[model samples]
Target chain A: MAMTEMRKDDDTALDLFFAEARQSAPEPSAVFLGRILAQAEGVQAGFCATPVQPAVRRGVRAGGLGMLLALLGGWGGIGGMATAAVAGVWIGFAGSDTVAQVAGYAMTTETATASALLADGDILALAAE
Target chain B: MALDALDDVSDETLLVLYGNGDRAAARMLTLRMGPLAFRVAQRMLGDRAEAEDLAQEALLRLWKIAPEWRTGEAKVTTWLYRVVTNLATDRLRRRRGIGLDEAPELPDGAASAVEQMIDGDRAAALEAALAQLPARQRQAVVLRHLEGLSNPEISAAMEIGVEAVESLTARGKRALAAILAGRREELGYGHD
Candidate 1:
């Protein structure tokens, strides 16, 4: 009985405290909603910008194409050098039919200059050394 | 119709409606819950302007979350109350270095017709007593007493155990009593 009574008293005290505290609290002004709506509108605007994804994809594709072209150019340069080397061998060995036919099978025009450049001196100097 | 007519509509339903760009639900939820948020913030901060700002910020956050608000995880009002409480606690801690003498008095009640029943000095004294309590204690007390949140709800909002909520409220009320005890005679609160 005593414990129950004590609990009741505690409840009463708590209630009285609430009643007092509630008196001091005020209602929020109307402008708060307007401000919230404005923020929401701004967020909506940002979401509207989502269509830019396609442009981003286009940029990625452009970058991929550029990389592919660079790789092709590098391999083309290497192929040209191999062709020129074989061509030089073909022309230099024309007196021997076996060597001439073997050279012809391997050589192209661009390879000859590259082969000369590699065999020759000052043109191939290292930059730092 | 009374505002309670819309209580049949669940908070989740209103959130969904608001998500679908129904502005009416936004207005309704703000109208219904804004006062509670403001009251909680005001009690915690003891400053009208700062409390208003915190309440507005909390509402804005709610608006931002309306698009993806998952229901049943937490009550909407509870979340707003917690956000406002946390914001008010931050502002209170930041302003702690300042002297209390210069702290602006809350708007005098007697100046307005509705608030004429309240005695300004007594109200001011109570607010001062509230200021003496630690931020957590004050928040626990306000959420329980001023905002009428249950112990479990207060625990969820405050991110504390129910026992901690109990302890904080008990200590807070005791401290408040001690502080207000001096002004009891002046405020006519000691008598029936």
Candidate 2:
């Protein structure tokens, strides 16, 4: 009975102490919620991708494409080699444009078209229309 | 142990449930402990934006660890508080290299003078008092009083012994009360 009474008293004191302390201040606003959620999303994405192998997926897709391209080249001879060389150069240039766009989006203003398309053609076509 | 009688379950149990993919447990734990965690981070860092981020990060980490959480170990909330405290300390350390700025003042509310007067600058005063304490002392005060943890629980949270918790809480409270009490007349806190 005495132990129980002591426990009750201890609980009461703890309650009162916290009650007084909780009167300190209010919480952050909904704006703060948006900020934290954005951060949480970034952290979650990083955690989710940690153990997954992007290389495996890329390897499977690339292997199939390589096999098909090799078959077409073998059948077409010189024409096929020319086509493949042109395609590779064109792809390299296209990849460069894409990398520029992404880097621009991350480092600078995404809305800036000049930065979004450092290469001449993509924006020139957009402008022509 | 009584389900119906459980006003609030400890963070450890909530953690175990959340780890097991109990969405209800996760939500309950967040709502139950979010305010306390946020307050502790805010008090320690003196920056609302950073504090909010730190609190969310701490909780997210808790969620990530839930799947592997062991029972009969440290209380979940204590672990969370420790994470928050450590994160806040890191922010402070980083700020030292990058010159920490004064916290931006919050916008004033549209309440009447009486209401404003009652709430007038109390938050500001509390923030100032919190800024004056050492990081560990501030954590002790916030954990014991504001966060409502027992000394033993605080020891577990702070990774210190119960006696150390007691010493820190006493010193912290005395310092905080002294700071707040000093501004009582100027801020009109003692009038009512």
Candidate 3:
């Protein structure tokens, strides 16, 4: 029992020291606090100053022609459609006789032109007048 | 937010505000946590300059982490305590060869007015004894006794179980008592 009391006494003594230590806890200098605050401000400034770049909405906003090209499967598809259109115009203007001539069949352009002029005699009359 | 309005704000709230780039919150958090970080660093490292450096580094990390700080996930003080202890432990490990006799002398201006109010000799004696302890024991004892952190808080700060904290503190107190036994009369604790 006496030994336990002695231990208690030692504990009490240590507690006093601990108390003193707490009371005497160090205070950081103003310079130290200022430095910390400065660092915080610098970091906060970094957060504010950086701008979040808006995502570039590429290809979707291209106007009417761009939309049309896109609908036609872009440049490659548009090029194919353009070629088909040119060929159709050529076939419509040159007629079947011209196509047959190009295929090495004997055909005259004058005969085809004369027949077209006869079918549209009003155009020939207008030219004569 | 106004600086005056932040007086009643919680640390986590202040951190969130600081994350949002609120200058008032930054000031408030620095004022609240800077001294705490320094005090614990000083206790653990026993050098004012070194303590200030460690405390600054810890607070810098806190600022850097502000944007990602998850409120309600952990207490701010607990995190700071853990960081300061870890940094001090790393420093102590690197300083393994340095003897206690080589401990830096306290500068003449190092003692503050509050330190003067206490028995400076007693505080010094206690500090010397604390310096003699193993790093973990000293950390446990200082946090438990001097800093008044509860076992669970110490456990969180030290990243150990509560039972382990209790064991460390018990052992630390016994060791401190043994180290300071001969100095009781010198420290005017002879009557006790």
Candidate 4:
């Protein structure tokens, strides 16, 4: 048919155009290629500069002390616990008399005055009345 | 590995090596894929400068993805083609109001004077007609005929169904045939 032949001719014409287009495909300039390569190198360098570190595993394998520390919330918790232990040990070594003296010094003025009154027999007179 | 030594190496292997911090692999991939990305971008966007920028951006994306590139998965060329076409489409969308007359002429820089005159005329004529097509048609035609991508490959690149790709290419070729029918003799194809 004439229509079929005409279609075939059109296909051939289009094919030639496509071939010419392919032959004349635009190429990147050397400078453009260089810039791309440099960017690649830079990106690769970034990966090298910041290697991913393995995650730190936790739990019993960290040892009993470490586990306790972790449970108590790390170094900050350990500091608070150490301070309390040291205070307890100091109080035990200081004896009850020393503790009483320190407690007396820490008492309010009203309590101190009441203690003085009891020591001076004021409490005994009030008791007789 | 040396650059030449990577001649037999697959793109996936090159990407893996690049991921492992091999500079030579990076160079090899750049050498091999950069032109492909550029050519596609150039055909999609008729401006040399815009095409160059788009190509660079696409390849930069490739570099960033190199570390996470999974071997034995998608081909690198397929990924690059998708990136270039998508980016070019976005740019074309932004230039919606611009007329076809505003498109900068593609340069004829590679050939000698006489050869350049003849081939450049044919290339320019085809490119001008290509620019007249709807964005999707131009993309389909360029990828199929010019880039020689198969329907399945173009389907993947354009993220469309294979049947849709077939339809677009068929329509595109017909449109191109009509556009260029008047110029066959001038382009040395002789009158129909």
Q: Candidates sorted by lDDT, descending order? A: 3, 4, 1, 2
Give the alpha carbon lDDT tens digit for every residue of A1-129 in model 2: 496664454444434434544785558676655554454444444544547654544323456666775566544665868888998897797888886787878766645745565667866877889
Query: What TM-score fits each model?
Result: 0.63, 0.52, 0.73, 0.73
Give candidate 1 regions above 4 Å deviation: A1-14, A40-50, A54-129, B1-7, B97-125
Model 2: per-residue lDDT, tens digit, B1-192? 333333467777766665554545545665656776687888788888778878888877876776677888776667888999878866765764432233221112211221333444656556565565556676787777776689888888888899988887766655555445445555544423
The CAPRI quality class of candidate 1 comes to acceptable
Off by over 4 Å in 4: A50-116, A119-129, B98-120
The CAPRI-style docking tier of model 3 reads: medium
Ranking by DockQ: 4, 3, 1, 2
Output the better candidate (3/4) by lDDT: 3
In model 1, pairs of residues that clash are A83-A111, A84-A110, A84-A111, A84-A112, A85-A111, A86-A107, A87-A107
* Tens-digit lDDT track of model 4 for B1-192: 788899999999999999889999999998999999999998989999999999999999999998898877789999999999889877886776654334333223212222333443888878877776667778899999999999999999899999999998888787777767667766788753
B80 Cα displacement, candidate 1 (Å)? 1.4
What docking grade applies to model 2?
Answer: incorrect
Assess the local accuracy of residue A35 in candidate 1 as a C-alpha lDDT between 0 and 100: 65
What is the lDDT of every predicted structure here?
0.68, 0.63, 0.84, 0.83
Best by lDDT: 3
> What does candidate 4's lDDT look like per residue over A20-119, in tens digits?
8899999999999999999999999999896686666754335588788779998898899999999999999989899998887878666767767675
